[model samples]
Target: MDTETVILGGGISGIAANYFLGKDKAAIIYEQRDSMGGLCDNFSIGAFKFDTGIHLSFTSFKEVREVFDMTPYYTYSPEPMNYYKGLWLKQPIQNNLFPLTPEEKVKAVKDYIYKPVQADDFENYKCWLYSKYGKYITEHFFLPYTEKYWCERAENMETSWIGNRLYLPEIDEVLYGAMSSATPNRYYAQEMRYPKEGGYKAFLKPMLSKVNINLNKRAVKLDSSHKLVEFEDGSKVYYENLISSLPLPALIKIMKDVPSAVKEASENLSATSLILISIGLNVPQDESKSIWFYIYDKDFLPARAYYPGLKSKSNIPSHQSSLQFEIYYSRSKPLSMRKEALAEHLIRVIEKLKLANRKDVLFVDIKNIPYANVIFDKKLYFNRNLVRQYLNNLGIQSIGRFGEWDYLWSDQSFMSGKKAAEKLLNM
Candidate 1:
C-alpha cells in the first residue's frame, strides 16, 4: 500500500493529525489495536464501564475547546482532594492544612511563616517544592505522593515539567481555604467536564467519524531510507512523509536502522508504566461526591482513584457505582505487587482509607499501560532530543506524550498532531 502520508498509531494525536490534514491530503492512520483512541479508550465489565484512566479534561483555549467540547456534558468545580495519612485532605495541602489536627496545623503554619530563602539554583523537584511550599507541606504531602506516583524521590527527579500540574497556593490564603471545605476551587482543572453518556472516549466521535483508519495492522519496521513502512503481516507501505504518535522507544526499535548513539539514547530514556485497577460497586454512592482524589501512601498501590459514576450515569448499572485507580511504576522502581494481587490490595486500602468498602464492590477489572506517564529526569532532555533530532532529519516527525517523550495532557497531545499536520503542509 502507498499513500502521501502514513500516520502511525491511532491515539488522539494521530486522529487529530488526520482530521486536520483533511481527506484530500491522501493521509491514513494505521493503528495496531482493533480500535482507535489509544489510552483514551474505554472498557466495560458487566453493566459498568470505565476509561483506561480518568479522562477528565478541561480546556479554555478555543482550538482545544473546538476539538473536545462535546455537549450534554457535565461540568464540575475542581476540589483539590488527596487521601493522606488515612484521612482526606483538600489538595495543595499548603492551602488545605485544616484537615490536619490543631498541632499539625500549627507546625505547618510556623514552618511556612519562617521558611528559609531558597537558593536560585535548585537541582531537583524536591528542593523546588520545599523552596516554594515550605518544609512542612513538602514533607507531609508532596514527598509521599511524589514517591508513590513517580516511584522516585522528588530529589532524584528533575524540575523540568511541574509548571501547571502543581498548583501552589499563597501563604496568607492557605489558612482560609484550609479552614473551610467550602473554599472555592483553586486547581486549574477548575471547570472539569465529562461526557453525559458512555465512557470518555465517546467524545472522540467527531474526529474519528470520517477518518480513514487501518486497524489491527502494526507498523513493525520503518525503512526510512526508501520512505517505506513494513508491518507485522509482511505488508509494505510507501509514504511521502511519516507522522508517528507511537511511543518514542517503540518507534526507535522498529526503524530499519539506527546509529549506535541514537539506539543508546533511546534505550536510556526513562518512563513510568501504569497498572490501572477499576472497581464496580452494587450500591449507589453520592455522599463522598468528588471526581478525582490522590492516594499519598506508599503501602497502597493506587496513586490516584476517580469516580467513573460522576463522569457519566451510563457508566454503571441502575444502582451501581465505580472507582478507577492508577498504580504507576517504572524501571527505576519496579512494581513489587503482582497484577493478580492488585485488586485485593485495592479493596483493603479503600476501606482503610474510608473511601469505600470491599463488600460494596461487585466487579473488578485491571489493565496495564506499558507507556503511561513519561518520567522527566535529568538525562531525559539530552537523550530524547538526540533521538528526535535524528528522526526529524529523516522527515519523520514524532509527536504526542509518549511520541515526544514528555508529560503531556490530552489538549497538548491533540495540539501536537495539529502542529505536525501544519509542519507537513508547510513542507
Candidate 2:
C-alpha cells in the first residue's frame, strides 16, 4: 500500500505530529501495542489506577495546555516531601532545609551564603549540583539520591537536562525555608492538573480522534531510499514522508543500509530502563496532603512514589488506597526481575520507612519499561547529532524524547512533534 505519510510509534510525539499535519496530508500511525498513547498510557490494578510515571504534570505553555483543556481535568496543588536517613524535608531538599537539625542547617546556610562555587564550563551533573547548592547539600542529599536514580555518579552524566523541574532557592529564601516548613513558594511547578477520572490517558484520548491510528503493527524494517516500512506481519508500505518516535538505538537498528559510523554512534547512545512497583493497600495514607516523595536513602529501591488516590480519588476504592513506586534499573545495575524476590525487598523498605504496613498490603504489580529516560552525558551532542543528521539526510524526521535522544517531558515531546511535522510540511 502507498500513503503520503506513515508515522511510527503511537506515543504522544507521533500522534501530535499527525495532528499538526492535518487531514489533507493523509497520515497514519503504526503502533505495536493494541492501544495508543505510548508513554502516556495508563494501567489499573483492581480499582486502583495510575499513569506510567507522571505523578503530576505542570505546563505553562498555551499550546501544550490546549490538549489538556480538551478533557475535563482537576487542578491540584501538592506538597511533595523528601525522606533522608531519618529526617523528612520538602521536595527538592535544597530549598526546604528546616527539617534538618540545627547543626545541619548551620552548615547548609553557611555554604549557601558564603561559599564561592567552583565555576567553570560544566563537566557533569555532579559538578552542577555542587555549584548550585554548595558542598553541604550536595554531599548529604543531592549526590546520593541522584546516584541511586541515574545508576551512575553525577560526575559521569551531563547536567544540561536539568529542566525547570529543579527548585534552586536563593540565599535569603534558603535561610527562611530552613526556619519553617510553612515557607514561601519554592516548587517550580506550583500548580498541576490531571484528568478528574482517568489517569494520563484521559488527556491523550481526545487527540487520537484527530489522527488515523493503526494498532498492533510493529515496524521491523525500514528501506530509507525506497521510503518503505516493513511490519512484523509481513506487510510493506511505501510513504512520501515519515515521522518517527521510536527509540534512537532501536530505530537505527531497523533501517537497512546504514554506515559503520552511524551504527557506532547508536551504540554510544544510552538510556535507563524502568521498573515500576505499584502496591495497593487496604489502608489510607497517613500524610494525605503529600502527593509523592523523593527517597534519598540507599536502602530503598524506589527513587520516588506517589499516592494514586491522592492525585485523584477515583483511582482507588473507598477506604482503600495505593502507592506507585518508580525504580529505575539498567544493565549496569539490574534489579531482580523476579516479582516475589522484589516483593520481599520492597516490603522490607516499606516497613522500614513506615510508608505502608506489610499487613496492610493488598497486591503488588511490577512492570518493566525498556526505554525510560535518555542518559545525557558529555558525549550527548556528538553522538545524538551524528545519528539525527544521518536520518534527516535520508528524509526521516525523528522527534520526541527517545526519538531525539534527549531528556524531555510530556509537553516538550508534544512540541517536538509539532515542530517535526512543521519541518516536513515546509519542506
Candidate 3:
C-alpha cells in the first residue's frame, strides 16, 4: 500500500500531524504499543483511572490551544501549593515568601530586590542560580531540590532550557506581587485544563480518531534508505513522508545504515528513569490538599506527589481517593535495585512525610517509564543537532518530546506534529 505520509509512533505529535495534513494524504500511524497516547496513556482497575502522571494543559500557542479544544476537558483551577519544610507555600514559592520566617523572608527579599554581580559568562545552572537568586536562596531552595528531581548535578544541565518554562520574576515584580498578595493569571496555561472523563489519554484519543492508526504493532527495524518501516511480525510498510515521535537515540539505532558518529551520539544521549507509584486509600480524604508536592531531600524516595482526585473526580470513585507519587532516578542509581526493594523504600518515605499511614493505604501501583524526559544539556544539543541533520538528510522529520529531544508538554507535542504536517503540505 502507498501513502503520502507515514507517521511512526501514535503519540500526541503523530496524531496531530496526521490530522493537520488532512485525510487527502492517506496517512498511516504505526504505534509500538497496543494503543495510542504514548506516555499520556492511562490504565484502570475496576472503576478507578490512573494516568502516568498529573498533566495539566498550559500552552502559549494558538495552534496548540485549538488542538486542546479537540478534546472534552474541564478547566482546572487549583491554587497550586507546595509542601516544603513542613509548610504549605503557595505555588511558585518565590512569590509566596510570607511562609518563610521573618529572617529568611527578609534575606530573600533583599537578594531578589538587588541584582547580584553580573557574570562574564552565564556559567552553569548552579552559577546562574547564584547570580539570579543569590547563594542562600539557591542553596536553600533551587539547587538541592532540582538536583534530586533531575538526578544530575544542576551545573551539568544547560540554562537555556528555562526559557519561559521556569518563571523568573524581576526584582520589582517579585516584591510588588508578593506584598500585594496577587498572583496574576500569568502562566502559559496557569488555569490549565484536563479531561473530565478519561485521563491524559482522553485528549489524545480525539486526535487518533482522525488518523488511520495500527495498534499492537512495534517497529523493530527501518529501511530508511528505501523508505520502508518494518514491524516485529516481519511486515513491511512504505511511506513517502515520515514523521517520528520515538526517542531520538533509539530511533537512530533502527536505521538500516547509521553512520558511526550518529550511533555514538545516540549512545551519549542519556535520560533519567521515572517510576510512578500510585497509592489508593480505603478512606476518602484529601491528605495532601496541594495539587502536587516537589521534594528536594534525598530522604524522600519520590521527588514529587500529586492527587489524581484533585485534578479530576473521574480518576477515582466517590468514596475513594488516590495519590500518584513520581520518583526520578538515573538508570545507574542504586534505587533502581529491584521493584520489591524500591516499593518498600517508597512506603517508608510516605510514612516520614506523614502523607499516609500503612493501614490507610490499600494497594501500590508501580509503573516504571523509561526515558520519561529527554535530558537537556550542551551535549544533548550537539547530539540532537547531529542526529537531526542526518535524519533530515534521510527525509525523516522527528517531532514531539522524545523525537526531537525537546522538553515540551503534550499540547506542545500536538502543535509540533500539526506544524510538521503543514510543512509537508507546503512542500
Winner by lDDT: 2
lDDT of 1 by residue, 335-354 (tens): 87775588788889878977
Residue 259, model 2: lDDT of: 97
User: 97-186 in candidate 3: lDDT tens per residue?
Assistant: 666777877788887766477654776787778777776568778877776677777788877777765567677666755565566644
Predicted structure 3, TM vs. truth: 0.92
Q: How accurate is candidate 3 locally (lDDT)?
A: 0.77
lDDT of 2 at 397: 90
The order by descending TM-score is 1, 2, 3
> Candidate order by lDDT, highest to lowest?
2, 1, 3
TM-score of every model versus the real structure: 0.96, 0.96, 0.92
> Cα miss at 133, model 1 (Å)?
1.4
lDDT agreement with native, every candidate: 0.83, 0.84, 0.77
Taking the tens digit of each residue's C-alpha lDDT, what string does model 2 give over 1-427? 9989999999989988999898768899999999788888888887888788854668777877888788888888767888888777887677789889999999998877765577667778887877888889988887887767877778888877887767878787888888988876567777888888888778777778788999999999999888999999999889999889999899999999999999999988878888888889999655454788888888888898888888788888888888888888776777765888887888887888788789999998888889988877678789999999999898889989899888888888889889988887787
RMSD of each: 1.5, 1.6, 2.5
User: By how many angstroms RMSD does model 1 differ from the true structure?
Assistant: 1.5
